[model samples]
Target: MTVATTDLDRLKSGADQLFSKKKLAGFSIPLVIIAYLVYIFFAFDVPGLYSRADMDNARTLVADSYSYKMHVTRDNRSAEVDISIEGRRNGTYPEDGSPDWVTRGEETVIDLGQGHIATFGPEIVTYTIPGYGTFRAEPGRSGVNATFPDGDLPGWINASKNRVAITTEAGRFTVTRNRTEVFRYFNGWEAFWFTLDSPYYGLSVGEVAGRAVQGEAGDIFTAFWTNSMWRHQDVAWALFETVLMAFLGTFGAGLIALPLAFLAAKNFAPLMAVRFAMRRMFDFLRGVDALIWTIILARAFGPGPLTGALAILVTDTGTFGKIFSEALENVDKAPIEGVQSTGASAIQRYRFGVIPQVVPVLISQLLYFLESNTRSATVIGAITGGGIGLLLTQAIITQQDWEKVTYFIVLIVLMVMAMDWISGILRRRLISGDGTGH
Candidate 1:
């Protein structure tokens, strides 16, 4: 049945009022609800996720890790003990690592007020209490007390940095880390500062204290000191190789994608039919991850740095094609129209009107891509036997040596940070038109 004109008008008027407020209200309720839900999702969790035992152990671990001996005291009882350590096991502590394998955990409660003298041959330890004076023993000795001058014990707790040192009759011996004990002279165990406030034994201390120094010659401390284990030549060549790979890959990809991005963008392309298809093609290439491409490339090309860098180039081309075309589409049309009004050729119009406007953007994108691709190169290096990463993978597998891994990782991190800084400077220069005229 046909509705009356008045009824139809009433129905339309009610519908408009309902939609005007409800349209925005529909979105508002969900927004507020979702925001509240998200807040709940992150703000709370299962109770006591970290067990009491874990916290106790972690505190013990941290205290022990820093060489601080922990003392427990309450209700007329006191116990002091050391915690276990964390680090690459280079055997730096005199405790378990030494030539005689002798860790002389020598502790003495001495009064600086009393005088006592002690002496040993070349490998003896001697300390004098102020008034009590001197006493001596062989390389290995236990608690031998000097007569207290009306005193129960001395005040200072003479704790070795980690182990006891053997001194000569003259009360002094050189602390050296040399094979064969150099019994000719003694070198004190080495202790080096880790942070501003505290110090820990250096690798040499572990080497010498363990008496393992005799078995292993030279200084472990010196070894850990250098920036790169590689000779200067290898470093120079490897650096050249990395820079060249990035340049060649980025240059090749840019050349291939610049035109593709133009054709893919509707603003420049007359064929709207092809534009959507090309845009989808661009998306397809960009969808595949870089590391995934690296794996495929490594398999097909045989693993190498070139294969790794090329993988980055292949992946980046698709991503940049999409980015470049969008940049192209977003270009100011005033210049393009002005050029067209003069009846300029297509190539000339693009060269004069489009490229100049977008060159800075393109360069910015390229530089950003370069920075991104460097990390990709390193990951690829891990998979494909390239750069320091390949060496790192090998080192980890061969020795299970976390220290060496730490060493390589530090280098990689520093390199990445340096590259980022360089890229940021170049990007700023390009955008601000301050780059040396290219």
Candidate 2:
């Protein structure tokens, strides 16, 4: 009876210890998480990051992605007036041509929408704001001599000895020693479908379609496709190159991996040394990320689409090797033995029995990787300077052409979506060996 009572007491003690451990673990987990979060908050300098963030610049960048601006610039020395979109030479207006908002004569008068007006005269530039009255500046060798209205200077105007700038809801104006310029913001991307040189520049959608129906479709398409500002043709070609890079890399890796997988698979490789070496080789290849390989190869082979493709191939070969070897290892032995029973050669057995069983997995993995590699190729092309990523990089580097950045991003998203759809269809059809996706 004493032994039985002692055992019961020991069991109760053990249960109490177990319950204590469970309670301690539950409390300790939450405490540890809280401590780690506090460490991260300080380590990342979250307060400093928040303090450094600029909301105005963020708003401007976001606005630029969807809208474009027109520049009306007057050379102070040459007395030459030029109007252009985004101040680009290719988007400049012809000498005699001007938007309806501007009147050219002895003085070039610009209507900056609303009640804001800016006029360029022989020696001075004047801006008239309905509620704020008029402001004037004479830019010359001395400086931008400026005059302001009564009361204190408004926060919207920035003035100095050499430069003066004014910003309003309607537009922005600036005067410097060399030039006086005004920027008028618009809602959409101008010259997207047709540039100023095109005959259909200002035509409505219905008008363009009517012109196409009248047998000018070829001319219309040519104008849009050859657009100097957007370069739709060049972009389309770059996209094609990106997809080609992915295709060549993915399929090339599959081809190289399939043979090596045999050496890595234990059932196929009689010697353990060969399997170890092949498996290690695969690990070394796939262990390094593709971007790292891209940088290394770019230095070796120089930069191009081929370099990007090779990088993808090298990294994917290792991955494919590991995956294919596992698949080969998991293959059913029944079919292989059946093929051997027929007195088939080793190669014939592998071809007829092993190949048929693993084909579905091979095709499925290859197609999925092909799709994933399409997106990877874009980033790889940026380093190699061969695909849409190059154009996207260039646009982002400009710091002013956010609309082009938007266009490139949209194209990339569409390309990825199309690849996903194609790969899904192929994965189903190839696995089922039928046209209808199962």
Candidate 3:
């Protein structure tokens, strides 16, 4: 009985120790997490980032994504005025005219709505705001000479000896010794379906449809398809190039990895050295990201879709090799043995036994990679200058083509979604053994 009592006391002591360790761990885990978070917060300069953020620029960028602007610029030296959409040459107004809001005579009068008027004379520009009164600037040999209302200049107007700028809800105006410019913001994409030069520019949808019924469909489509600003034809081709990159990369990787996977699998490769070499090769491939590979390949082959495809192929080959080796290792041995008993050669045994067992995994992984690669190809294309990514990069670089950027972004998203759907369907059908439609 004394021995039994001692055993119970020992069990109680052990339980108490376990509970103490558990309690300490629970408290320590939270403290460690909090400490790490505090370190990250200071290391990343969270407060500095907040101070550096420009909310006004952010607002303007967001606005530009969905809107367009009309530029009315006058060369002060020659007194020549030109009106264009977003200041693009193709979107310039015809010689015959200007918008209804602008009136031309001895002087050009621009009505900026809500009683805001800007008039450009031979060497002077005048802007009148309803409650703010009139402001004028003249470009001379020295600089832009300016006059304003009696009170202190509002914060919206910035003036210096060489330049004067006025910003209002209606529009913006800037005057310098070289030029006088006015910008008017408007909602929606400009020249989306047809440019100003197109004959079909001002047609209503119903009118366009009637024209189509009357055999003008080809002309209308040609105009839209060849739109310079939007570049519909170019965009379509870019999307195709992107898809091609993903296709070649993913399947090429799969093909290259399949055989190599056997060399890595311990069950198939009897030599430990060969298995280790193959595994390390895979590690090397997947370890250095695809972007690094793209840069290396671009140097060798020059930038193009093919180079991007090769980079993806190399990276995914390693990944596929690892996955395929694992799948091969886990495969059932019964089928392999059964095929061997039938006097099948090594290659034939693998074909009839190993392939059939892993076909589903192979197809599923291949299709998933194909889908994933489609998105990867876009980033790769940006580096290679071959696909929609090229156009996207160009738009971003322009800094004024946010609308185009938005359009390209939308196309990219749609392209990825379509690829995802296609891959999903192919995976389901192939895995279900219904690929032949029987």
Most accurate candidate by TM-score: 2
lDDT on C-alpha atoms for all candidate structures: 0.55, 0.93, 0.92
Task: Give a tens-digit lDDT track for model 2, residues 1-438.
Answer: 999999999999999999999999999999999999999998999879877998887887899999999999999999899999999999999999999999887799999989999999999899999989899988999999898889899999999999999999999999999999999999999999999988999999999999999999999999999999999999999999899999999999999999999999999999999999999999999988897899899999998889889999999999999999999999999988998999999899888888988888888999999889999999999988889889999988888889999899999999999999999999887788732222
Q: How high a TM-score does candidate 3 get?
A: 0.91
Task: Give the Å error, residue 177, model 3.
Answer: 2.4
Better structure of 2 and 3 per lDDT: 2
| Candidate 1 per-residue C-alpha lDDT over 35-62 given as tens digits, one digit per residue, 9 for 90 to 100 | 9987777676424454534766554334
Greater TM-score among 1 and 2 belongs to 2
Decreasing TM-score order of the candidates = 2, 3, 1
Superposed model 1: Cα runs more than 4 Å off: 1-245, 341-343, 434-438
Q: Tell me which of candidates 1 and 3 scores higher on lDDT.
A: 3
Clashes of each: 36, 0, 0
TM-score, one value per model: 0.51, 0.92, 0.91
Residue 15 error, candidate 2, Å: 5.8
Could you tell me how far off, in angstroms, the CA of residue 323 lies in candidate 3 after the best superposition?
1.0
Sorted on lDDT, best first, the list reads 2, 3, 1
RMSD of 3: 2.6
Off by over 4 Å in 3: 1-13, 54-56, 340-347, 435-438
